[model samples]
Target: MDTDRLPGCYRHPDRDTGIRCARCERPICPECMISASVGFQCPECVRDGSGTGHAPAANVPRTVAGGVVPADPHLVTKILVGINAAVFLLGLVAPAVVVRLELLGRYVEYFGGPVEGVSTGQYYRLLSSVFLHVEWWHIGGNMLALWVIGGPLEAALGRVRYLAVYVLSGLGGSALVYLLTAPNTPTLGASGAIFGLLGATVVLVRRLRYEMRPVITMVVLMLVLTFVPFGGSLSVSWQAHIGGLVTGLLVGLGMVGPAAGRTRALVQWGTCAAAFLLAAAVVLVRTAELT
Candidate 1:
């Protein structure tokens, strides 16, 4: 018999294989072959005989970062967008809410309400500021970027990992702003988190073996624009952008780096915790200096 006439794998018809599933007696390629007590079996046979009413551990689908593939990959992105929208709407009605939540290192109320800012133990501002947006154009630009970049990232890194990157990135931005900018200067926007997502996107795209030019170009352009005077009146916070970018790059490396399985998870979360602690340390140091 001509060897070319050999049957192809049932699951992958393009690949010819000599081995057959022990249970189903169907041809299977190496990728589809699972070692059994007697002989190799197909993935379907193994799943059916798993006896646990679920796919075996090996059969469960997982994201690149080892997160279980979720049913709705974009769910977290949608929720985040909703939250930012809600906060924006609330700010529209109660402008004070924006003032209360905006990232201020230190600001004294001239009216004698109270001293307010992160330096005054209002630490929540580091994160709350991320969701607070007052300008229509500001919210519009950020939400658009978030939906476009965050959706694919959430799917690749999984929801928990994605959310961690976002929050930590925002904190990283706030921490840098606190450390570098004047205590009285107030800065607020989601650009920091968005920069973080862009950083992470670079890692994901590289891992998937896609072209790097587009992403690299975008990053360089954004970084350059951070310093360029838009109209010589409004200035962007270069510190926050740089801080978030570095944090995202570090976290992204941990998520998709060489580590595998449990080690990958450990490295991923460890990197996240380290990034958070580092930002917290910066905040503490800045607060100490301010007070």
Candidate 2:
């Protein structure tokens, strides 16, 4: 009949139970636990915590609980921009390595021989192509666009989701290229994924109910830039750009709406999976035709 005489702390067996953590079922004294709105949580639980495997916590921001938010958006933006700029700078210094690294091919009939081997099946290009740019100008332009858009999107969507959108869109765009293009021609750049981020931004800003004029203007500018032919010819894989854009739009839609709880999370996962599968199918069919 004595509640004060409960089990000692799970972590510190010497201590008495002062409170119960709703999450871990461990007894925690006041000194060992912080009072959350839902219940007490140990310091460790709060720091490296995963969601309850289904529903996310409602009171806490999704990004906060997910630990995806960047502490410094400006710094992150600058770091990414700096990396891309440095790569372009290096490209200018070593043209042959840049050409090979960029994965540009000998002719439109076949993509870069080495990269084509990797990209032929649409396996390697999904991730590798993003890091490879056609030229100094190609890298610079993508980096500049990333500078202008990536920071804001990362700030709003958190680094994890922003990165997810960027990568998935890039993969989606690359898949489109592998499917649609003449398999012999080589193409490389982050433009597709960058365009996808643009598409994601359009969805995110609108969902957040923020003014979308800037995002619209930026998209228009990028589209124009895409067609201006900066990479020396029409071998730039515009199909990937469009594919990434569409992928971003779909992912962004899933991310939108204020349903951070478990119910909405399930829906988001399903929707995202379907979209990715559709993209993969396109890649599969196109690769089969090429080989």
Query: Listing every candidate in turn, what is its Cα RMSD in Å to the true structure after a full C-alpha superposition?
Result: 7.5, 12.7
lDDT of 2 at 233: 57
- Which whole-number lDDT from 0 to 100 does residue 16 have in model 2? 60
By TM-score, the best candidate is 1
Each candidate: what lDDT? 0.82, 0.63
Lowest-sum lDDT 10-residue window in model 2 = 58-67
lDDT per residue for candidate 2 within 1-291, as digits (tens), equals 875455777778876654566577677643445434454566556554543342334323324112244457456557666666666666667755444443321223224444333344336546566666646566777888887777767766666666677778887887777676656556677788788888988986665444578889988876776667855654456787788899988887876543445555566566678777987788667655555
Highest lDDT against the true fold, candidate: 1
Model 1, range 209-237, lDDT digits (tens) per residue?
A: 55578899989988888988878766688
Candidate 1 segments whose C-alpha is farther than 4 A from its true place: 1-58, 110-115
Clashing pairs in 2: 55-262, 109-184, 110-184, 110-185, 111-184, 111-185, 111-186
For each candidate, give its TM-score against the true structure: 0.80, 0.66
